[model samples]
Target: MSNRIVKSSNLLNSFRYQIENSQKGVLIERKALLSSKNIELHFYETITRAKDVLMQFNLPVIAVMLQGEKTVEMDGLGKFEYAPGESLIIPAERKLKIDFPSASIENPTQCLAFIPDASLVEEAVYDYYKKTDTWDTKSDDGKIDFSADLLLRDEAILQTVNYLLYLFQEKNEHRDFFINMTTKELIIRILQSKARKAFLNNFQKNENRMTHIANYIKRNIGNPISVQDLSKEANMSKSNFFTLFKNSFGISPNEYIINEKMQKAKIIIQASSDRSIGQIARDLGYSDSSYFCKQFKNHTGYTPRQYERKHN
Candidate 1:
């Protein structure tokens, strides 16, 4: 997925004068709009950078871009651009190196980073799985994969962020209680966006069998997998499995497996310098490093070394 620039809200510019005049020169300067026991609203601004600024957050963040452009290199995902009207979810513990290629004194890059409560996230994820019939209750990894970093702005989420910003401005005894309620609602909207994405992935049924198999494959990617084994796992005959798999995803089961393996390999290649190509190959059940290299090149236009060079 790629970073998207959605329609910006009028409310976003309400603090522009304060944000623009307050910072300059620092790689990724920030101002705290509001900080509570469970919620944090931050204003992040950066000027045109001669160098990249590295950032890491302990908590998961929902970053809403309000002004200017930024090219970000994320851990698993390669470099991408974030601009106004766009919002992205940063998975907890992911490191990012961001560069403000288009930012300058006249037009600085401004954004809102929303750090919601961890317990609220867990609660939302739990409630989503509990209510949704699509989820496999037998699976131990019940949490949603918020790792898909790029999220195009949806009106519902943007509106929630806007409402939260407005809530921060209020000074009343029940402010905390109302903010807590809105935070939970925001969590639900985020979960809804995820659910919508999952739905779009399958395009068949709500409890999409192919989606289930895809998730299963991701979880057991390290193991030796075969079409026959996967068919049995899905409780379908070989022919039926092949047909269904092809219909759900345009690719065959074997191709899909290789694609998933290579995707994992790309992440490893970007994340670590210590792991040899052979080690990554073997970890993905490829016994022959040469064959793995060939497959990697065939799948992605670049070989492991070339991919590393481009990303590093």
Candidate 2:
């Protein structure tokens, strides 16, 4: 029971850290773009760029054109022309270049750029290359339209965006936490408001035993889980449970748990450098120090001590 509690605590903290640290920019230098503190929500007053404003991105980002005529050419994501009120989901695997040829310097354009926690996209949604069976962006461009409601002048959203903007203007340690936390919460709002309906609908339509177990495992990753327990939970025999769970998640439950543990451990190591590796192993509920170190080495190619030394 105590081991379960310790695992639960470690899992909770590490999961949150992974979600928060999911994005790291290779070329980000400013306090604004460099930090993954909060899902970045900023309303740009607009700047007059050369006829073709080209911005290179190492990661995919989203842009919502609130007010202004603009064109976004996504390298692999696709191209979009934004009118006064519309939104676009910028794919991360491509370089995005936008142009505002007709914008007058006298009246700079007003648009909102929503920098979501890149990690959310990294996990929840698959990449364009692998989405042939899912929502194919090029095959069905009309099916991928973004929501314009989020851009409206609502007081709560406006205030939140404004507060984040001011916070990013500073170069301080607090900005890191502020940026990560804010971005995560904002994306959760987006998921709840827009994406939740479609996902819930899909889940309901396919409420089979396998899907149920898969979904439950995601929510209860830190628990002391077993194939027998999960099989019983789904009212299936052990053999049937193994077949279905593997079929759905592409991996068995035990493999999934180990992967989740290593992922959580990586986040904890990245965030808190002062914690001893033995402490991390114990916190993650590894009873044997040597065993945990071996597992960590197998998964990451770096032992726990090496990971701490390099990451810190």
Candidate 3:
């Protein structure tokens, strides 16, 4: 759930030039890398440590950290460390007070601020609601809430942002067209990731039927739970339940069950050093050790034993 910075010779060359010619008086040196009707990408470099530097944008901006670290403070969201392999989504017109604690002439802090057109975001939201028939009820207007900032570690978003950077840095006649297409994908990924976060954060306390089902699954995660059982709990047909659950959380009931079990298995493995893989599988209601191992590897990219070795 982390992003890796994409470094290139072109980027390094540009960064070197900027570092050498950095302004002495300003804390942050801003360079507009690419600008189009639908999107704008700007590069920022800070050559010295500073505190409480204010920044605001007219349009929603996604800030990607490439080098060094920053302590960012927003109105509602307090201070948090913004470092490499992470991103922050700032709503339009929200002011940010940022501190560059590690910036220096030798190692300047670098970041990219991507601003997609407001109309583009609205279009994406409209398309999402139309396709999924799902809305965020937590929002008073039944829309995705962007008033608060969002921190993201979604790799898909990171990759898309990197591609957009590549497009911005390169000299291509079709750059705007490609940027428009790629920005649309990035917007959808952000929306879906935000929706998933909202659902996970509120599912425990929210008294909706979906939250009730989520609670039941969490409580009985070590038991055999099927969509049929969940449908019975929801008092709906199997197909209807499946659609409703997926639409609500962007994940199927069975997939959610597997994810919950995998998360629990990770905890059990990390909490104890003496537990055997077969026993752990059984504890998670997996009668077949081989199947459990397969699922664990598929979900975590590590086998149960490997995960234990790596973590413990």
When sorted by TM-score, best at the front, the candidate numbers are 3, 1, 2
lDDT of 2 by residue, 1-312 (tens): 111101111112211122211113321111122234435443443334334455654433444444447777756545656665344444444565777665443544555456555354333333221333332112122233333322232333334444554455556777777665555444434343443333222212213445556655666654556778777666557897788778777888788777877887898899998888777777776767788788889999999778878988
- For residues 1-312, could you state the per-residue lDDT of candidate 3 as single tens digits? 225677432464543234333445554544445576788777776768887888888765778888888898877756788878677777567778989887876777888888777666556555655687664434444334433426877788888888887776667898788888888787778767754433323221213567668878998888889999888766567998899899988989989999999999999999998988888888888889999999999999998889989998
Worst 10 residues of 2 by lDDT: 1-10
Question: Which candidate achieves the best TM-score against the true structure?
Answer: 3
Candidate 3 stretches with Cα past 4 Å from truth are: 1-3, 8-30, 137-149, 195-312
Residue 139 displacement (Å), model 2: 16
The lDDT per prediction is 0.69, 0.51, 0.73
lDDT of 2 at 277: 77
Candidate 1's C-alpha runs over 4 A off are 1-28, 126-149, 195-312
**TM-score of every candidate relative to the true structure:** 0.50, 0.39, 0.54
| lDDT comparing candidate 1 with the true structure | 0.69
Clashes of each: 0, 8, 0
What TM-score should be assigned to candidate 2?
0.39
